[model samples]
Target: MTEEKYAGKNKPALSQSGVRWLWLAALVFLADIGIKFLVLDRIGYGWGNRIEILPFFNLLHVHNYGAAFSFLGDQAGWQRWFFTGIAVAVSLMLVFWMSKLPAREKWNNSAYALIIGGAIGNLFDRLVHGFVVDYLDFFWGSYHWPAFNLADSAICIGAVMIILDGFRSKPE
Candidate 1:
């Protein structure tokens, strides 16, 4: 028996969608950097003010030389190059992933953009100052969340969106 043959299946194109994804990524990166500049100029590094917006929320400025919560902070000099290398590698991988995504995969695309922006934001800091500038602080009593910046927030939000999208059916 002859094998069944199929032809003319319509594959979704991603050229346009990839461009949009890139544009959004660029915008987020710019915004993240712009805010950092403003904060650096107006507030200056290592300077922060606290406002009681709730029972357990405050904004503050803190520079971190290591990973989250200042882990490996005491390494003295190795972490700067280490984290910078990691960020650069991840950014490159994410860009390749973004290019491979189909047009209908909006959620994935957005997630990629966020991750890219965040990576670049931190990468810039590491390259320029050897550390990251974190300004958002949250705490309840003696417990305090690690200080973070807008780039971190974007990365978190994008990750959540991607996880949620996975549970949903794939777009046609």
Candidate 2:
């Protein structure tokens, strides 16, 4: 194929790349922040203020000071900046990767965009609150899972999509 065919309508390489899907990232980021702030405004923090929504779920405002599942949340400090740095670095790297992929690579593009969105969303929280805001709560019988927010969910979903993409059959 000629450069015209690859670039499409005289667009630049970056514009023709999977970066087109960045709108999805922006959407996820906006939605994540909107809900987080709304929760912050309406819900009182901690388990004692949980609002049960189902037999297995609840809306419980909480704060995570570390990585996923509160990996080092108990630390006096430092983990906050550490995770923030990771999020910033990962978001930038994914955006750059997306800019190199062809627009047709929707699967990988979307995965990258989702992760970028989620990473930036949490980064925003970390910068603004010094912690990640979590609200969704799920439990089974007497076992309760840690509360997490939409940003966390987006990151998990994006990661799962990337992992599943590895199993997809490639074109010859």
lDDT of each: 0.74, 0.88
Please name the candidate that would achieve the greatest TM-score relative to the true structure.
Answer: 2
TM-score of each: 0.80, 0.91
- Pairs in steric clash, model 2: none
**Could you give candidate 1's per-residue lDDT for residues 19-130 as a string of tens digits?**
3587667777898888778767766445346544678776555678887678887897899999888888987887766655555567778888888888888889889978
Tell me the TM-score of model 2: 0.91
Return the TM-score for candidate 1, rounded to 2 decimals: 0.80
CA deviation > 4 Å runs, candidate 1: 1-14, 17-19, 44-55
Q: For model 2, what is the alpha-carbon lDDT of residue 47? A: 92
Q: Which structure among the candidates has the greatest lDDT?
A: 2
